[model samples]
Target: MRDYLFPTEIERLIAAAKKSPRHGVRNNLMILLAYRHGLRISELVDLRLSDIDLQSGRINCRRLKGSTHNIHPLEGDELRLIKRWLRVNSNPHSEFIFVSERGTPITRQSAWRIFKDAGEKAGLEVNVRPHMLKHSCGYYLADKGCDTRLIQEYLGHKNIQNTVRYTQTNAKRFEGLWR
Candidate 1:
């Protein structure tokens, strides 16, 4: 069984998250940010409002597992989604970027459930977990022929070996071997 999702599957997951009857905006943003920034579930749940700089269209990703933290550019869709989420958030005064309906900070388990449910709703055959988003990000970049060093930096991998897995499995690496 493949551990990571493809870009199309990621899109399907995001679309499913957006259709949640409750916490739709927050859930959608969670999946989107996690995939875009390659955030671990812990990092994603720990995010606070202060980490975001909407004016500059950037986000300060505080990574986990001794990974290097970095600032990532926010895409136009991400910017718009953040704005919409902020405007409609249930607890306007909450410090956390993502909160439960009752205004408490979201727990890791809940975050897991969000992805699990979204995956089921999306009709994906494989069981999906939150970390798949991170894996998907790595694989997606590798497939796109992004430099390994750049991917490592973006994903906050301190060791090149960790980043190499993504490149090693890349089908593009053998593109012209038989030609």
Candidate 2:
């Protein structure tokens, strides 16, 4: 599948989301979580109240792709966003990390729609999906010089080869050097 929003596009989407009255907070938080955590929509939707440990900056992801559980570290902007989201939305009775206005856990389809709508509102011309955010996380991490083995594990890819695809250096970056 085509990779989702580019870095610039993601920024624009977040900016647009910040202006939305109804979903501004939730949408922006979702964007931050997706890009920073490399989480699939299913994984994101499945997040429960107990999965996050803000004090420790860790997130526990359960039943990831192949019915496996993993614990991932959160840092930088991702951790901050999660903390903010929790402060704004958390309730004693709710178990899901993200909830709809009706107080139901966010569905995967809803998550996809939120990202797509946010991208359109931002005037982004590319297709945006929740998985694209996951791809962006992997791509950005690889670009920042993260080791492939680590990136592979973080993304929960069972095969190293699939993770390698995320690390494909942008050919355009080297085009100038060839001249």
Residue 175 lDDT in candidate 1: 90
Which pairs of residues collide in model 2? none
Clashes of each: 0, 0
Give the per-residue lDDT of model 2 (tens digit) for 74-136. Answer: 876777776677777735368998898777888989989988888889998787878888888
Please list the C-alpha lDDT of all candidates, in the order they appear. Answer: 0.94, 0.79
lDDT tens per residue, model 1, 1-179: 88899888999999999999878899999999999999999999999999999999999999989999999999999999999999999888999999888999999999999999999999998899999999999999999999999999999999999999999988897799999
**Model 1 pairs in collision:** none
Residue 173: error of model 2 in Å? 11
Candidate number achieving the greatest TM-score relative to the actual structure: 1
- TM, every model: 0.96, 0.85
